[model samples]
Target: MLPIFLKTLPFFAIIALGWFAARIRFFPPVATEWLTKFVFYFALSAMLFRFSAALDLTSLWDPAFVMAYLGGSLTVWLIGMAVARARGLSLPEMAMEAHCCVIGNTGFLGVPMLVVLLGPQAVGPVLMVLIVDLLVFSTLITLIISGSGRGPIGWRTVAPLLKGLVGNPMIISMAAGLVWAWLRLPLPDPLVEFLDLLGAAATPGALFAIGASLVARSASRIGPAIWLSFAKLTLHPLAVGIAAFGIFGVQPFAAGVMVAAAALPVAGNVYILAQHFNVAMQRVSTTILISTAASIVTIPFVIHWITGGLP
Candidate 1:
């Protein structure tokens, strides 16, 4: 247990450093935006592209794996919605807070942590989580948030979503990589090296950006924030475990991958979505901050269990 905790400490340390740097204004204020842009536009995309491009087509098409993750995510989201509505939240507030329960920081945090803990094999399931989030959870949350009180849903409501999905760098990179993998295309050595270099920087850069984002944000409404964090850190992974181990009977490693990915903190995208729709910014930011800080303790234990530490 001590060893596992020590191993996971550095990931949190990188984030802590970022938070401290932001608090001190170590880099220019604009540097945060630039780092985010680089991770979103370049490093993350490159990392996904390289992994997806090389992924086995069979691995990409796992129905059992998909069912385990997507089903678990939907189940948790519905539960969150029920709790939010019971709390007397407005429709938009319910949507925004519920969104945090389902979607997670998969790209930046999940991918890097899983890759470090489980290595390259982790990417396939993580990619599946990303697809489900972008295609299903993200789209559904958008409709709920944007469509609320505005009128019946229509093309106008969905058009922006489609456009954003189409233009999303991570989605585009993954799709291209899938196509390339399907075609069994070979990349030139120079391009491969270039992508490798960018991919190498993605994990640390992303962790740092997350830490920095937390520095300015305060965890408001602590009770609700902690509940939402529990929904994410505990319930989400529990659902995935049931689906993967009991229902899907996925292999241990793959099951572990799905569980760990599900255990990730609320996504930074939740903040972006809240800001875009102008709702629940404080709650969303607080959730991100608290859940991320808590995961440092929770994840190592979760990983240890999945790796046979738990009886």
Candidate 2:
């Protein structure tokens, strides 16, 4: 237990630094966006790229666990969407809220954090979730929210799907990294070292951006945003846990990843989707910020209790 906190503290500490910077208005709202963009497209992606480079496919392709994990997330998204519709929200807003609930911050947060807690091997399972998070879950959310097909599959519909793919730097990084790793091509020393330099900046840079984003005003309602946060940090992990152990019989390392998946704060892409589609960006953005800050504490406690003593 002590070790868990010891390891988790540094991760959260960097985020705290970011939160402090945000509070100080170091560069104002616009600068926050720039910082976040830098972290997303360059720093964070470089680390993930390296993580994937070291992944061994045989271990990562656990069909039973991957299918169950992906399947569970899909179910959660469906139910969440249904509920959002029942609330009579607009499709774009529904996408925003629903995405907040279902998608966790698996990329920027998930990769580096898992690397710290579970070592290089953890990259394997995180990779599995990243695939589903980017390729499948993101696509599904955009298809539903951006277009209704009530009249026709206009450019409106196609555009959202394309945007879901290309606009997300994390997803693009994952795809490119996977292809390179699969091909087993050697990365030149200078290039790998350059990536390493960028990779090293990933964790702290992302945490800071998340903190800064939280400080800026996003147009979101208090009630809905709080509810979204509660759902993401608490209930989402429970759903994943139950399914992993009860339905899939996921054990040990694989099951640990289910916890990580469940524990991720919220996908950074949620805000982008929200902004593009005119959803509650303030609420969405803040929820991501707050939940991510909260997760620094929440994740370790959950793992300490549920990890079944994985020293």
Candidate 3:
């Protein structure tokens, strides 16, 4: 027990330490944005390319994984949105808050962690999670946040969704990799070796980027942020666990991944968008930090509890 706990400690430390550095402005502010874009656009793209290359399209065609993930994500989305509305949040705030709660830090945190803890076997489930994130969760976010202008589903907002999804770095990466995998193409030793070097940087780079961005947000709105963090930590995972076990009867490693995802902190992208639009930045940042810290404990226990033993 002590050994397992100690091993998991570094994962938590990376995020917490990174958050502390971001608070102090360790990286130059100007450099941070560029670095973020580099991660979002470039690093993420390459990371997805690597992830996509790992699996055949036939693995992607698994309807069960898709449905289970969507069911879990949508269930949380609706519940979180309703809670935001009940709290008397305006349309924009509600949309932003709901998105923050639903979308986990899947790319920055989920992918690398899955690869390390679950090994190459994690590729399939991780791919499924990524697909659900892009196609289901993000698309749903856009659709909810975009208000109808004089009619239903305005084209102006719709364009961003199309652009974002179509032009998305990860999605594009996945598509390319999917083609390569389907064709069963082999890369030269040099390229494979090169990709290995690039792949190694994904986790640390993303966690650092997340840390740099976490602080310097709406620091005043700590109240709402704490509430949301509480929800994200406690409520979201409970919802996923219930459905995964009760409805789908998901067991073993798949159940572990689903529950781990549910236990994830608020996604950094929400913070980026919130800050971009001048929405609830402080609260969102707070939620990200608090929930992430909490998950350090919650994740291990949940993994142990749900798996019927330590996995």
Tens-digit lDDT string for candidate 2 (19-95): 67878876577877887778888998887777676666656677777767776766666666677788898776766
Residue 145: error of model 3 in Å? 2.2
lDDT of 1 by residue, 108-141 (tens): 9888888887778888988988998899988998
* Sort by lDDT, top down from the best: 1, 2, 3
Best by TM-score: 1
Q: Comparing 2 and 3 by lDDT, which wins?
A: 2
The best candidate in terms of lDDT? 1
Q: Where does model 3 exceed 4 Å of error? A: 23-25, 148-150, 306-311
Q: For model 1, which pairs clash?
A: none
- Per-model RMSD to reference: 1.5, 2.5, 2.4
Name the regions of candidate 1 deviating beyond 4 angstroms. Answer: 309-311
Deviation from native of the Cα of residue 308 in model 3, angstroms: 5.4
| RMSD over all Cα atoms, model 1 | 1.5
Give the alpha carbon lDDT tens digit for every residue of 112-145 in model 3.
7766766666676777777777787777756765
